[model samples]
Target: MDLVKFFHMNGGVGDASYLNNSGLQRMGIMKTRRIIEEAISNLCKSNIIKYPKTLVMADLGCSLGPNTLLVGSMVIDEVAKTSQEMGLNPPEVQINLNDLPTNDFNTIFCALHEREKKLNTEKITDVHYSPPSCYFTGVPGSYFGRLFPAESLNFVHSSYSLHWLSQLPKLREINKGNVYLASTTPESVSKAYYEQFQADFLQFLRCRSEEMMVGGRMVLTFAGRTTEDPRGEESYYYLWRPLAMALQEMVSEGLVDEVKLDSFNLPWFTASPTEIMKLVEIEGSFTIDHIEIFDVNWEAWKTKKYDNDNDNDASTDDNGVGHAVAKSVRAGIETLVANHLVKQ
Candidate 1:
């Protein structure tokens, strides 16, 4: 697939839009908020600056949605709180929200104004909280390459994004039946996947390293495997396996072409901590400051449940999880798949 043009999250405010299907990612963002806060706090305590005039921060892969601003607000709030506790005036912030060129920046721009108004309205007392002076701008580009001027950024953040490679591997045909790394995929296929991730991730670090000043910090949260095996359960295969199975069933029923199914593979790969650290070490750009790993239940995003409470509970949960995963993946990739099928 053309990763640059095709790999964007579902846009707009429809039911299937990324705004609606991204609860899991939003939950992940909330879970990591403390970690992000700590990173910014530590950066402040490190004598990186004595209340610098401007704090330049960027959220790489910050797709359009409430979560985008939500995280930005958290980062800004933490910076202000930390500065206040340290008896230092908080610096004015330049918040850069970045994503692919095709991303729905319009929605983010509209919401930015709304968020400022809402924050202003919530200020009630003499000692009331006010968000730090901040400027918001849209950066339409890929994070795999340099997106900012050298030594310009003070903090960087990305969540639920780096697992996606800039592009798929060259040996795409090796994993014929699978849409991602699977048990049946050949060793060559797995090796190719690993190589691609390493290349993309190293380039990403190199680019960011150039943009960030000395003592700057970055916090990234994304889907990753605890096991070294690329096909491990924590890998994104949890979602892709069920979706691939459903697509195979469609092929069996003549609803989809088998060739197209075989030719399609997700342009994503999950990295283990070991894999990530190795690339970081090799790149020699930044030190491994901190790393945390955790799991989220597949059905954790569900807002409704079965009424019987015991209606084949295990089976129902499994089906419900699969449906949720399928819907999320569909929202992300439906446009690409539809475009390809139409050309065929």
Candidate 2:
């Protein structure tokens, strides 16, 4: 599908939706946030780093709205609670919410504004509240370069985002027969996925190592798979392939030209726990504070519960599925496929 059309069909559904309460509940974002907060609290208790005032945080791939605010609030609340328990003053905090330039900045800005208004009206004077700032940038490209200065950040957190690389792999490098717009074979695609992830992830860690202060903590949560299928029949792929095939069928019916479908590839990848652990080992700077797999309660479209819903209701559920699929698809597209699947 033409990039623009594909985006029009699927836009505002990926990371953007994940930043909202509905999508967060479906993807266990609140649970992940709690885990991250606890980790930050533990780090504070150990005195591995100073409390409150010195803490600076960044949320990589923070989409557009409420989740960004929630992340900022969670960090601040955790720091304040920890500081009070320790009889120390709460820290000065700066949260940088980062994402691709194409993300909904207006929504993020609005969310931040709302958060600030709430804090001001409540006269929340306990901790110094700094407005969350946002940066339009992608993880693989400019994240380490201009977004943050050297040795400035105290904590780094990314949820359902890091699996994507800055870009896709090179077409010339892959085997001939194994290549397809969407490869279903595990071996053919897994090697490419692993290679790109290993490289981009190592770069991510190295960049963070430079950006973070000594003893800083980093927490990342992402979608993972039990199987090694490059194009396996998982719920994620099931959600997207229909859309992709729909677009392709549109091409066949002459609703759109072949060029349109040719330009698009499904974006998604899933990493096993072992694969992630190996990548961490190669990256070296980050210590694995905790790794927990939580269930993502996806309400599939073809399920009986969805059959009776109206288009609006179906679309809402579709948007949730879209969010989950985007994370997985973006990972595969960016990390494994040679073709540029994700628009940006």
Candidate 3:
């Protein structure tokens, strides 16, 4: 299947939509808020913004949801505050929210005005109440390739995005009845995944390098494991294991074909920090200024606090955590399954 044409989260603001099922993803944005602020804050403090009248930034893999504006708005807010502190004219922010062509970009487009209003510029005593003019353009395409003109971007931010490879790895030995790297997956399959990640990640860095100005700041947070063991990568287990088990149960009940399960594999990999560092060293476009890892509870999105904190309409009872997770997984990969696994 052509992933660019077919791959997308369940669209519309329904119960099963990615718009509603993305609390865990929202937590990611909140968790990494500081890194994003610090990057743009430092950028504004430097001579970079002093020269340019425009600030170009992008949110790669920005699927449709309330969380879509969370980071983008924060960048605008930080730039406005920093410009106010320095008594400089704020630059107009040009935001490119990039994703596949099939993503629900309209859902994001409809909310840009309100996001612009709440820029948090209390410190700016200009009395005119002027903040940076933010222009959001939905770039409907994959981030695995270049989406911007050369040296045009000033800053870039991506969270919970890079783990998705451009395509599935070429497996010499398919791990039947599985969708991702697992304990029973053959070493060759795991190696295939690793090599694919290395290749795709290098392309990603190369594209960003050519598109961004020299010393342009970027904050990237993705699903990365600390363990070197591919078979034991924690995020994959939590993210894919449950869905794989459910598929296997269907296979046992003869509802799903064994051959279909044998051929299907998810196009995702959770690289470790070391693996990422090695790629950056090879890519040689950006420096490893700061690198760290933090753990979130596997069921963090199941908390009642998440419902109250985020605009997500997804609610989970104590026992509904499992069901919520199932729905969440479906929101992400139902296209892949319907196209590749269930096609008859």
Worst 10 residues of 1 by lDDT: 306-315
Candidate 1 residue pairs in backbone clash: none
Cand. 3 Cα-lDDT: 0.83
Instruction: Report, for all candidates in order, the number of backbone clashes.
Output: 0, 12, 0
**Ten contiguous residues minimizing lDDT sum, candidate 3:** 304-313
lDDT for 180 in candidate 2 is 31
Q: Give residue 193's lDDT in candidate 3 (0 to 100).
A: 95
Each prediction's Cα lDDT score? 0.79, 0.56, 0.83
The all-Cα superposition gives candidate 1 an RMSD in Å to the true structure of 4.8
Query: Where does candidate 2 stray beyond 4 Å?
Result: 1-26, 48-52, 123-141, 144-146, 172-190, 259-263, 300-344
Q: Write the per-residue lDDT of candidate 3 for residues 9-83, one digit (tens) a residue.
A: 888888888888777778777777888888888887787435468889988998988878888879988888888
CA RMSD, predictions in order: 4.8, 6.8, 2.8
In candidate 2, clashing pairs total: 12
Estimate TM-scores for all models.
0.90, 0.72, 0.92
Question: Residue 122 deviation, candidate 2, in Å?
Answer: 2.7
Q: In candidate 1, residue 124 scores what lDDT?
A: 50
